[model samples]
Target: MKTLTYVSTKSVNDLTWPTTYDNTNIYSSALSVLTDFQTAGPRVIESNTRADELVQLMKKEHVRMKIVVDTHNHFVGVISLEDLSEDVFIKQVAEGYKRSELMVADLMRPKETLLALSYTSLKNSDIESLLYSQRENTLQHLLVIDEGTKTIRGLISSNDIVRQLRLDVDVAFSSFEHTYHSAILGQKFQSRSLKVA
Candidate 1:
């Protein structure tokens, strides 16, 4: 029999967490800000999940969006915190549907209405270029597609960009659309500063 040695925990005061790319500068690869499904699994929910349940889960996890899937786990659509806003629920209730009966699919952005960027293109781009290209759009989350594999690869969130770059703008009280616009504006100012230096 072999005996295993145990280390003392008394002196260990710090915990280690996983880290991604060390260089988070604007010129760094756009992938640095992406939540890659290949590396970290995508956040998903079943289409039939109750709206209230989805809201609770999102709030508890501090996630603003989730990919909607079917029983077979195929991506069908996406749902965001904005989609389940109190206003939307109130409107639905006014239309005669009970709150308890609402499902995620009822408010999700269908797959047909969504757009995705090619993984190949994202790999060749930098954060500055990516933000510049998407400056006019209000989409909170941009999905990445691996066209060659015919699969959903990952997503880039406006919040993630704001956090990763340590931007001065506060996103907590801002809507996703506002946050996206703010991030773009912040990036532009930063780019100009870099040029002036």
Candidate 2:
């Protein structure tokens, strides 16, 4: 194994807001999640990757979704927990074999919903607001990418953003906004119910 250390400068480009929607001001550089600890950075899949390969890898790692990168290293699409859940849904529909029997191609949904670009502020809400909104929504994950390359640079699920902000469930509950928190709120709501309620 090889380890490489490089110096990086912190900039606004590196900054990200938490799900709080409170605009509490979180510097993306403040905390480095596992996403930053990666050596090759993050696990990536080619467009041609088989559904079976992705399913096995995701299940093994307990991952709900992944970013799709092409041979040119260009961002193509996103895969979500809902997309992966297709395997289980499929099995339920067929009542035939286990979900493990399905492949990524057969199950993974095409990348559709998105949260591209880190610098782009979400809902123009504060940190707390963002969190509440994300939780109430139907999306399970949100991807942050480079606007120019459109390549995924980071992903922030309602869970990921919440954990980063260290917000409490009670606090989140007291501040849930019914409007202007669509994407964030919608996604979280989806995960908890596994349905876009």
Candidate 3:
């Protein structure tokens, strides 16, 4: 056995906080904003969870989105705080379903209808170009796929990008469609105006 020496804590005044890439502008690399699952685990929820319960849990945990999984933990879909909003539940109630009977799978964006960006492509791009390319997509959260491993690598959130870059754009909570039209399209238009000026 080797002898080990213990250091004194007398001089330690502060703890080092972990830091991510500083995304101070739109030109920052797209990878900088990715919530890589390999590093930080994805927030997930079960498909059979109650919608109202999920809303309360999300609010309490301060989580805005969660990857939905089946009982076997297989990826099934994704659900955002917006997915469990009052209007959505009300719509289901109109369709003859009881409010308390709604499940997360009912409102989640199913995997079949989702699209993802390849990790390789994202690594070579910047935030501005990425957003410009996705201007036509009605997405608030974008998944990143690892083509080589054939697995989900991570995700990017429009809200995170907007916050990190401090963009003067509003991502309305009314609906994902409205957010796409107003925020993404607005960015595209803003860029065009800047070029003209």
Clashes of each: 0, 34, 0
Residue range 39-151, candidate 2, lDDT tens digits: 33655566667655676687788766676667886656766556655556665558775554554444544556444435245424354444443444555555555555545
RMSD of each: 3.4, 11.3, 4.1
Question: Any residue pairs clashing in model 1, and if so which?
Answer: none
Ranking by lDDT: 1, 3, 2
lDDT of 3 at 118: 95
Tens digit per residue, CA lDDT, model 1, 6-90: 9999999999988755558778899898888988999999999999889999999998889999999999999999899999999
The candidates, ranked best first by TM-score, are: 1, 3, 2
Top-TM-score structure, candidate number: 1
User: Which parts of model 2 have CA positions greater than 4 angstroms off?
Assistant: 1-40, 86-126, 132-136, 148-151, 165-197
Query: Each model's C-alpha lDDT?
Result: 0.85, 0.51, 0.82
Off by over 4 Å in 1: 1-7, 11-14, 20-23, 173-197
TM-score of each: 0.85, 0.49, 0.80
Candidate with better TM-score, 1 vs 3: 1
